[model samples]
Target: MAAPATATILSDEEKAVFAELRNEHEKHRSVMIKMDRYYEGVQRLEHIGLAVPPELRRFETVVNLPRIAVDEVERRLDVKSLMLPDDQIANEDLRVGWEYNDLDAQAPQAHKEAMIFGRSFVTVGSNEEDPDQPLMTVESPRHMSVKIDNRRRQMTAALRQYIDPERKTDSATLYLPNTTIWLTRDNGSRWNVTDRDDHNIGRVPVVMFLNRQRTGSWFGTSEMHDVLPLTDAIARSLTNLQIAAETHSVPQKYVLGMTKGDFVDKNGDPIPVWESYFSGIWAHANKDAKVGQFSPSDLKNFHDTVNHYMALAAAITGLPVRYMGQQTVNPAAEGAIRADEARLVKNTERKQVSFGASWGWSMSLRERFRTGEFPRNGRIRLEWYDAGTPTMAQRSDSIQKLSGGTPILSREGAWDELGWSEARKARERQYFLAQESDPYFQRIQEKEELNDPSILRDPVQEPDHA
Candidate 1:
């Protein structure tokens, strides 16, 4: 009776739908695999916990480096207010945009939160009569956090290299800038805020290393008509000098202002005057007549223009410029001062070990290795030595106590009855009995003196009471 279901021969439309579904499924599966890998890594580390071996940890804080005067550093960098041709400026912007996009593609999770606003805004210099405007007026307020990819890994790598004890390196290395979002409203608003409810527009500091061991740099592009012409410019036109001091080998107490009030006074003034710094990366400023959608060619043209400007700037400065802000250090350490920071203190704890020459031993403790939590318990081994004049065979006579384990935790009631010390003594008694079957160690009396000198001569003697 139905119009004889017109021969449903797997229509092209249905095939297309099936194809789309397949693509989506593949994407989701890939994402799931990646997430699984990430979780597995986290689980592995979490099981290990934060309890690092004493041998691997540096409990001591070393020397502190003096903060560089912001004004002085800015003067040295010499930020220019140069304006480039319109076409060139547009190209630079698009190039930076592409790089940023590439960055996003690589780390979709983190880069999604990034803010790229300056590509549309322009900063001009003073003097309306002058034809050229400023590139960008950079205001350095003491310190700032700039964004970077894999920020934590980058910082840790730098710290590891800088503080390698084997190398005995003392000089502080400059860190790439940790960039924060800097925005302007319309054309004449403050270069800080972006939202109404969010009034703390200055800068949101990102916490990575507690110490000021990292630095940040930001890059952008502007048009020639929007900034100054630097060809005829002199060194003094925009230089602001400040002093940088280095202290001697002494650990000084330097406070990093974590709270806003620490850096801002009641009168709303900055506590320390930072050296202002300004610099630009290569960028292209395209002004195409057509106002429709931009084509891939348009983007490519902009990228090329930016590369050109970056090359020019790098040549003039004789330093790698454009979109890089790697922290630097002076190899000579001429201006550096030495100061001792902190020292490490060692603590001692008494742990028990069993002696079993040519015999097997086992020690066990309750342990739970969770996916995202610390381990419940752990165990270690000690080599029991031969009672005779120390020889390699005597050293090899020890049996690992952890080979077969013991429950670290016991019922509170059972613990109360046995007492922890009594329980430990019981384990020692069992361990001694295990060696009874082996004639070589059978005569090693339970109450006899051990080879280790640390063993007490008198059992009743109390160790340092503390």
Candidate 2:
């Protein structure tokens, strides 16, 4: 309920941090422009279609074909299957609160959109009137700044900027160490000196969403960067494709040779070489008069080149070649389909691990909202769906083997491992438990557990049940 980071003045060091942050923010804005262009399928003719040559314009009109945007495919392919899919937030009370905050529906969508900009943040705090349900909202990095301690070991302060449309002014909130507002500035200049103290993480109340982070760096890179060069290449290919189509479709004209004597006499009389020399429809009195037909050769070459680049884009961005919509092939085997997406699956898993931490931190912040405590715990984790899944077989052999091999593993856990939905798993678990509840099945299961040597191994430690 209390405001943090409200102050009228800033220290010299704090001013320096703001100066550096503003500079870095400019770079982020530039990158976002490029990323947005690709994400929205707005690959431009800005560079490739600029100037037109006079000769080519005479033969075939150049047309801009649909831009083959690799950015959205790459970004989506990386995050689409990266759903946390975890039961971590299945707490009954928190479920209501998550829905109350609209985070249940929007979290996944916001996370993907944030990845496009390379970073996002979630601000978790509470309103005085609604103390029971803490408020949490996702924030774009463009509107926020965070300053960490010199060692980079801890973040001590944060600032949020807002532009008031009605007032047509910029306002800033500089929050500090004690969950207190250190500074409040209204309608300030861009170069205005920026306005930190808290080790209490909850007091900061901002959790950063950073994924696909490169080593030795704090910033994350989007898939747009991975295939940025390919966007131009793909655009060039499509443009050439249009040129080829136009060239092959347009008419070509030529003339056949005839006797020159028919052109004129020695008296300088104007004469036509043929009955209709320039008539467009040629006719000759003493020679052949026909329009020559032109066959456009090697038109396939243009399309072939385009297809090659599209393939390259697919490979670089981990998008399936089928997404290019070029050729038709028979349905692929399950293994082959999985192979095509192997790179994508790996990328998605990496995102899950990275964003999992961020989500877990957000959950922690959500708790901080409910309780006045800065943090409930230092350790947190999120469960993620398995990579390379959506198997054709709902109940796999490996799942059966797992159940038979580990008596300690719950039936529901085994089902979940096979990528079964919670609802399906619940139904299957109930059916199995009902069947196994009989004395006969229970006696058989006991005998099997007793026969397992791993369970009898000298003082075997209890394995953690999934």
Whose TM-score is greatest here? 2
Candidate 1: tens digits of C-alpha lDDT, residues 254-286 = 222234343444476655534110110111122
1-466 in candidate 2: lDDT tens per residue?
5444344466676666555655666666766666666666654455434444655443332221112332333243221111223434234454456667877455765566556766777777656578777778787776766766656545666667776466556655555544533333455554332332232543567777775666555556654565566556666666666676776655555555655554554474646545335552354354564457586656667677767866776777676777666548833677777777787777777677677677766766666666655344452455455656476463364655767855655655566556554445557878887977789888998999999877655535767576
Tell me the spans in candidate 2 whose CA falls farther than 4 Å from its real position: 3-20, 48-90, 165-168, 180-203, 255-290, 374-377, 392-395, 401-466
Question: Candidate 1: RMSD over Cα atoms?
Answer: 34.6
User: Residue 226's C-alpha lDDT in candidate 1?
Assistant: 17
Q: What's the C-alpha lDDT at position 197 in model 1? A: 16
Instruction: Please report, as a residue range, the 10-residue window in candidate 1 with the lowest summed lDDT.
Output: 341-350
Report model 2's TM-score to 2 decimal places.
0.68
List ranges where model 1 is wrong by over 4 Å: 1-24, 27-41, 44-86, 91-466
